[model samples]
Target: MEDSEIDHVMSEIHLGCPPATIGPFLSHFTFSSYPLLDSSNDQSMTISVDKDGDLLLPRRRRRTSPTSHSHGSFTVTIQHSITSTLPDVGLQVWKSELVLSDFVLHNMSLLNGLVCLELGAGTGLLGILLARVAKAVFLTDHGDQILGNCLRNMELNSSLFHPQAIVNVRDLNWMSEWPVEVTHADPKPFCWSLQDFEQVKSASFIFAADVIYSDDLTIALFSMLKRVMSLGCDKVLYLGLEKRYNFSLDDLNVVANGYACFRRYIKEDALCDHSDKKSSFVGKRIDLKQIPQYTKGYERGEDVELWEIRYLIEGCPSNTILIKIQIKRPTNIFVESISKAYQALTDPGFQMGIALPQFLLDIDGASGGILLLWIVGVCILLPLVITVIYLSRSSKYTGNYVMHQTLSAYYYLTKPSLAPSKVMDVFTKAAEYMEIPVRRTDDEPLQKLFISVRCELSLDPKNVKQEQAKFWKQHPAIVKTELLIQAQLTRESAALSPALQGDFRRVLELAPRLLEELLKMAVLPRTAQGHGWLRPAVGVVELSQWLIRVVNCRLFPLVQGSLLESEGISPFLQLAHFSDAVVKKIARKKVKSFQELQEMSLEDRSELLAQVAGLSATAVEDIEKVLEMMPSLTIDITCETEGEEGIQEGDIVTLQAWVTLKRPNGLIGALPHAPYFPFYKEEKLLDSACGCSVEQRVVLSWTKVEP
Candidate 1:
């Protein structure tokens, strides 16, 4: 079937448009092509329409291979009479039949009267169509053969080009720098510089299609686009990319990353305006009409939505919003999450080692924290301690070996088992309790011992549970008792012969694993049962386990003087202070206030409770009823007076003062301000009180007036 016939069928099927006939009248339609015309010679040629109404040219008797042509420039001839036509190119015919051609053509045609450059202008059909309306078109390709073929194609239908249209075909390898100008035979100068062209001088818009399919090429294309756009382009450049499913997720990620990285750099440099200014390309408000529809061949089914992103070139430079893309797939969520996480981690303002707020770090931080703790612990223990100590003590000392093994296990398991800094704090506190100088070598034995203990505890859950129960029964303070035992064992082991020291060190190393196993066994049942109190219990047990590990790992080594003299335990000590502060804060704010009851009018009390509640609950049933009964009642209060008030208590005084209500411990419920006292004034004292005592005091008691 003819290209026109196929297009008619597709248009009918997809667009609900009536089919149009591809009759003999269409044969006279000549698609424009630019021939390599010789400027030195003027020749007249006859042209005629074929029987099918297509433009016909003379055909060549014999065909010359494209490779046989001279490398500089050449032309070809057709020998067929002006009345007979040849078949259309297979690919062009196929593309013309596609339903998406209408969409692509519509968007491309909108760049009318603009100086546009098309990269990788295969066959130059789209570029040629663009030149029909564009002020000027520069069509480029990396292959000379392709350029030649495109020039011929353009020449064949030159009548359709605008009278002022200037089409210049050139070879442009994207990886290389573009040259300033190229000389042509038409006596008109063609220069890539903005200074040479009025349209280019004002603004140079770039249009690309099907460009981001490969990693290296996509990078090169975008890199070139950035360079070109930065070179005096008055407005932000427009990029129209056709999505291709052949591209892998990895490739898309690379492109997305590169775009984000460049955008960030531009923001930091204060180049692109990320706030206030509207995009010149897409305009300020992105209504549904502004978003382009996906062209056919880009996707298979019904029209897929195309996303439009716009950025203004002036205003606040740091803010960039993703404007109009709808997330439809599950992987889209994951990709978005990863992109956000990558940005947060790489952002310069983001702090490492500290736990950021939940909103800032997101849920990924929980996983990141685990990995970071393990890495930091490994750094502190392995190479820093074991390697250094082994080299220094070259006599194969058995006592030192045993001590190192025990401490190493303790350090490893404990630090890895808790929050990074919290584990460090436990070690510092243990060192203080043991009165030992914290040293690097001391860290090794504890780390080793912790690791050994962790391994053993994991192997026997029942045994560890029994041990935990026994310890709890014998000593109510299990953690403290265990620490004391660990300290005593370390001291005795250090006092023994080298072999005995090794044996004791080995046993001490098992402490962390045993404690962890016991804590796990105790907490597992509660966790499985979904008990409400399980959280606090688990937290306490974990803290206890960590404390034991720290004692065995750090404190024992410090007591034995395994560390060097220069290193101070300040970092560990600071961590302890932080942990204490966290614990205190948690304890203070754990529940609402607890205070003795005081009688008051329900109406006044409801207002006070309303202030505290602040939209949490609408009303309490009994309190509402009580408030209705005691609408006005005398309430005891203390207040601070500001400004002038000239009257004594017994002088029938009338004065204004701000009233403040106090809670327990004399803490003010709120602040002294307006609305609470729009007409707050001291009225004349009422002596009509039946038998009520009227006492007033400057200090704690009220002063009394005898009736």
Candidate 2:
């Protein structure tokens, strides 16, 4: 059988119309293209397989004759076997592997002298071929058993790979923190280290086959891929997949829905574009053309979907939008009606029913009057009762559904003398004084709101007028800047303590307004005391740099999956435990977030860390440890109020304290460089003159107290 015959058979199988010229599909493709004439029923027969899934049949050597792309034909020996019900699926070669292998054979020019990494390299088919032309090839997959099989297969084809070209097999689990292990080989050029994360990160091209199957794996795989792609490498990804349409028990016969999920994942990855039921994947920098049928004689070649992903490094039109949208529910008229009816009925002057005279019921000639009275009573009472019932049935709590409009914007205060713990205490006491049920949220954005004090505040006096003008233009609807001056209490400035009380009061007054302006500017909500306080201009120049770090940390996974997840240069501005100055230094070197830093090799990361201006080696190690130990989940804070009782709304002032010792995300002990031990607690009643770091983020609201 020739490649044309295999292609014809595949087309027939895909049509599901009739059995094509009966032939062995797997055996013919696996072996030489010799027709194995068999009944169509024999196609479903299973071959005997060993525990390791190696074919039990006798081994035979097979070779593919060379084309213009190859110096010589490639050969391999294999034993036919059936895949077992094992967790390790890499023991078998799927159709996508054959398609990718064929793709490599024809495109030898792309691999020559480049470092390649094959993800999910089942049976080492594609890796073996890439090893011929590539300078080095790293074949990676999960599970020790699967890795063992890969090593065995690679060893079996030792003659096929170039002598100078290095072929390494390693274990790569997408969700684990375990370092990948490089298989030891004799005559190796250099000793492999567990810190060779750079090798994978710096690969010229990445190849993957049939990896996206489940939703969980899909999310994890893409997250891993995005992290890998961000490492300033040759951003080229070649993925081969046989569109698998899994059918539900209810709709087993529907083929359209079977491949629906697969198609959706592909589309979400920006691999294909769909319009008017016809799709085109060609883009300015990305192309995902299907390997045309007859590209190779793989079994079911027509079913394979080959995609080429070329990521534009400088700037690609991203489909990812990091903005989180919040929806508001429509007001309920039924509930309003019931509330009005209840209020009307409960009034002291309300009557129970129609004010009818006793004579109206007794008089036979007055039956018309009685009937009229009854109709009036029915009309008034029936609808109210029905309305009450409907309201009771439909009534649901709306308080928990916090609308976006209701959320108070974050206030950023630079070089504040108050502590975040102290600020939270003040707010908690204020809420208590007002009798509002206020609680600190584990919301990530809210955490970031408070945790951003560590970053630098870039303020510029030269462009203050211009930036403010641009800000007003950009945020015409946001709060006016004049409110900052109007809201200030300059008359009593002489009475307040200059060091803490004055600064605290000023921050409290300016925070909300600052938040409004920053949000309008579409930047992180941070601000300084004065226009010239931060040294550099507080415009997009400094804000964008900070935002890039935030985006890299929080939204990288989403952006990798779909460029549509966000638009423009928007970043999440995620808060980190480390100080802002250190993060800024790291960001300057393109090390945006701790996650990215953790992904780097120890030596490379250590060298980078040493370059930071003020950081010592010990401090760098501590920071690294802190980054490693930081929990993925949000930490909780405990608020402790004085007296444990509610104060009058008009009270002059109240004392409160906040403490948080619990470190979530499996972190043990106190965080590195933290001032406190096991816990951090601060009281609002602390003297204004008390020593506190200027880096603390303290929020104070005194004028707002009604008393």
* Cα shift from native, residue 707, model 1 (Å): 99
Worst 10 residues of 1 by lDDT: 684-693
State the RMSD for candidate 2. Answer: 27.6
Question: Per-residue alpha-carbon lDDT of model 1 for 243-279, expressed as tens digits?
Answer: 3233337556324323333233223222333455642
Give the winner by TM-score.
Answer: 2
RMSD of each: 35.2, 27.6
Query: Looking at model 2, which ten-residue stretch has the lowest summed lDDT?
Result: 684-693
The true-versus-predicted C-alpha distance at residue 26 of model 2, in Å, is 13
- Per-residue lDDT over 362-478 for candidate 2, one digit per residue giving the tens place of the 0 to 100 score: 888867966777777788778889999977644531243322222232123222333322222122111111222122332242223222321211214578667445533422112
TM-score of 2: 0.32
Off by over 4 Å in 1: 1-112, 178-204, 236-238, 246-707
Positional deviation of residue 386's Cα in model 1 after best superposition, in angstroms: 99
